[model samples]
Target: MRHFWCILLAIAILPGFCQALDIKGVHYLSLQEVAGKLGMKTRWIQQDKTMQLESAWTKISFEVNKRDMTLNGTRIFMGYPIVASRGRFYLSESDYDHNIKPILTPQLSGAPPGLRHIVLDPGHGGKDPGAENKSIGLKEKALTLDLANRVKSKLQARGFRVTVTRGNDTFVSLENRAQNANRLNADLFISLHFNASSTTSVSGVETYAFTPNLQPSTSRSSLHSSDRKTYPGNARDEWNTLAAYYVQRSLFTSLKARDRGLKRARFTVLRDIRMPGILVEGGFVTNNTEGRNIGSASYRDKLATAIVDGILVYKKTLDRLAK
Candidate 1:
């Protein structure tokens, strides 16, 4: 019986399509059917118009004839609006699959339990210079350290106990950085770095969480992809995924930077962290314009503030869930 329902849910969750499509080419499912089928308790708040669903961990509110839905208080934009017909409200396929599914069943990135201590990792130092653009005199190692320091201060101001892997222009192995977070019992880990590419024109910010088990990474290369292995990092894949989303969203939205999309990678620093962790490539150092922006102290401050803001947003969501 469970297997049968699993197959049903699978059918309902296909990308760009919901459980069933009407003759009108609109894909949708009954609000009650979706909630009952998914084992979520549902109620109508406005006698018939507003529908609410709650699971053990998530709460979602929707309205008939409305294009917006609130998942745990976060407004989600849907491709199709809810409509009333045959005395039932039908939810759009895109909303159910993309916006609703991720929050309700966050297989990609689970929400964190709480936010307390955060470890900021500044990538590359000492003998290693990390990424650099000699044309602009910007070195990744230095920029990361600076960004980490500023982020640490901002996080501290927000009452989060913050620590950095490298506080100065010194060397710290990737292994040690992860170990340090485990040692401190940090709740979150964020590694900071600026990117470099041969193509100087390309520039943007992308964040990475550890590759989930059995899933190919976003940048999976036939040459470098490895057999699926569950590391300590994969244990917190949920938190890692959510944290990466927060970081990427916060940075790009506040700084008006390019969106490079969230990614999955198996960097040693992220692979071994016991807590939810992510690495952020802030921007392209090889780009003439962006490289200059990254080199600016004020710009680094903005980036740092945005990172902190993102963590706060992530924390706020978890805090609401706990309540």
Candidate 2:
């Protein structure tokens, strides 16, 4: 009988239903607000299987489940589990779209939110010749700048605001790189470089985060225990951990590159920056074959996409963890 009455009530309300009002912010409406909007009274019965709402000439009873919600004794599907937050029932966007749209006229197409600003730092410039491969004549500084530009473009397309440390051929100091990030309040920092080795066979991608204990000398010669040149403490540690986990994972998954799991070391940009910073050794420029591949425009674009995807994945994980 409850189911039958709910069906009748739904039919009565169907013809006069108006489009849903715009929902602002990132929160859901309360049940009382939902009832008032729908012109129905809602009640909670002590029995787990049944609920009652009395308003106007109708009384409705429905059963609530972990994955489903029944209204007027009618079973309704839910996209995610029903959650109660702050003493109010909450449903995801899926539930609102699938279950409520038939009765509510206004519908919105879902678009993912844009990411916060990203700071791209091209490693080495001017006097700094990071690495060189004879075969393709790829210089680490030039390649890093090119790759950084490509990454900036791709990230822009994916709705991320992008800024580069050096737009052209001029060199930017390590201090300026971190300062730029601080000025922009960037969310992610990526520094691009290519690796070199005495052995020509070394090839693969490696990502580094910040480590207070692993601070190396400015010349990369020997450990400077007494240098007293260490910058601030692990200010960027949290961001680096997130960056390392997401970037390293995404790079290997998409590019099928070797996994050089997250490592910590003293990279000026990573250590001084206030945000999550990562330095990417795209591939071994010392390797004959890998240098050729890194020089290609197509491969650079793929690499950019991988980095962007990693940022997105990290963003999602952060969102989930925040809840």
Candidate 3:
């Protein structure tokens, strides 16, 4: 009977075998069923139009009609909004399989992959200056390269091998960046960049993983035909989420910056990468206050330190799971 129950539990999580409802042409699973499978308890807050799934180690909160969700206090954007039907909330099957399940049950996905070799991509070089604040004499390309070097120093000091995509201020194509990492057999890839906005008031840190197959990116409100296509990075969806979560959490907490949430995008640098990869928007260079801060060497050092701290935390998680 014990073995029978274990078999049943295993069967419950299989996408093909699990029960689902067709909602607006998409398959969805009830929050109740999700909670049961994950050994969590569900609490519905009618007043707030929110539902929470809580366990000893994790707390996941979802709001009706919103793609934003929180996991263990860190913000993450779901591919689809939660829907209410018959007083019960449902999560899209795509998000359940690609986002929620991978994050909550990382161990079940597979053994943690090798994390010693890291590839750091400093966004925009040579001719491409990326985002810039002319008034503050700040350039995104120069800052990213400096930050990459600082992070490389810290990571190397910790005994991990690190590689930078471009060692100088020379242009490197997006395709070449991913291909270089693949050729070097890098375990992890991080693309570093500073952001700009027409509204200079916008300033925060954002981390992005490759958008999962069949799921809309965080930037998109609806799924597109291209969302159905799977990329090489999709193979590491679980690891990508885990890595991006840790890095984004660290950046937000350490820098006390606005929490922009963990997002997903089908960026060329991440789409074809063969390893767990993420792109980091360190901060906005357009903001008056933030632009000046970014121009200073100390703040860039702090950014590098925070990023390395996140990498360390991620490595520790893998180490613990391996044990």
Candidate 4:
């Protein structure tokens, strides 16, 4: 039954009209290889004691009290323990997001200290079934995860460190979600979310970033200014000012979806994060045509590819600016 569903999800990513992505040479590490590469040994400590391993110049440990885990003495709350699979300790993708990646990659860089750690948050999970596309019988949570996973795969292939908020159909709170990003000091926080309208007439793709340090009224006024300037409109008018300018732009080219234009708004997830953050409203699930497309494996794959392209573009812009 699960395999049947997996196949369906895989099919949905192939958006028929879009060009296929070049996804070659993506290497994922096994738990033991990940541990061994760092010169750490995995031990099954049955006592109330902690299990610690040293790797990549970082010391990692699992706490006996609760699921609390840490690396380099920094605390990370894991909802699940690292499991041993095939004689090696394997960390679930979701667990890696909350526990391992936080300590491994804390900065965003283009081949500097290392590849940037990205947090791909699939908004609305478990009981909170975000928007529903009745036409296709697709739940927003399912679509979000499907796209997030695909994005993760493509990015991994392209040599970027990626993390996902929810790996399965489980509930995760906003606070915890933000905390994961905060703890990791993520280079970027990209939240995957689909739109829904009661009228079913609305459809388009929009990206959002939190208002700058300025007050809401002031920001709103600036957004409405005759200059026609938009969000992240800095005094210097820097490139990609909307926080996701390049990403949103690249996405439009890849997905060929409606361009709703980037905007500024107060969202709980984006506001508190320190790094550059953007929330992607892919399309409206309420609209019949879009709902079905969102439910398809091919389209979801394109969506994921579009997102990965955006991130790569953002990285290139950052590198140029840094130089």
Q: Which ten residues in a row have the lowest lDDT in candidate 1?
A: 14-23
Clashing pairs in 1: 110-238
Better of 1 and 3 by lDDT: 3
The lDDT values for all models are 0.77, 0.63, 0.89, 0.61
Query: Relative to the unseen true structure, what is the C-alpha lDDT of residue 151 in candidate 3, on a scale of 0 to 100?
Result: 97
**lDDT by residue (tens digit), candidate 3, 1-323:** 43354347556774333334575578888787889889999997554499999999999999999998898888899898988754667898888887777778877878898899999999999999999899888899999999999999999999999999999999999999999999999999999999899998999999999999888899899889999998999999999998999999999898889888999999999998999999999999999887888888898899999999999988988898898
- Give one digit per residue, the lDDT tens place, for model 2 in 142-230: 88888898888878887778899988777789988988887898877889888899999888876776653333322343345633355
Per-residue lDDT of candidate 1, residues 134-245 (tens digit): 9779899999999998999989988999988988899999999999999999999999999989988899888887876544455553223353467899787667766777
Q: Compared with the true structure, what per-residue lDDT tens digits does model 4 show for residues 1-323? A: 43354345556873221211111211123344456544676555543355566655877676443344555543433433444322333344434432354234323222321227888999999999999976579799989998899999999998888888889999998778877887887777788999998988888787765543322221243222332322322221122232355556656667777766555455667655656677888888999888888888999998888888877766765565466
lDDT of 1 at 74: 42
Candidate 4 stretches greater than 4 Å from native: 1-115, 215-243
Top candidate when judged by TM-score against the true structure: 3
TM-score-based ranking: 3, 1, 2, 4
Highest lDDT, which number? Answer: 3
What lDDT is obtained when candidate 1 is compared to the true structure? Answer: 0.77
Q: Residue 31 in candidate 3 has what lDDT? A: 84
Q: 1 or 4: which has the higher lDDT?
A: 1
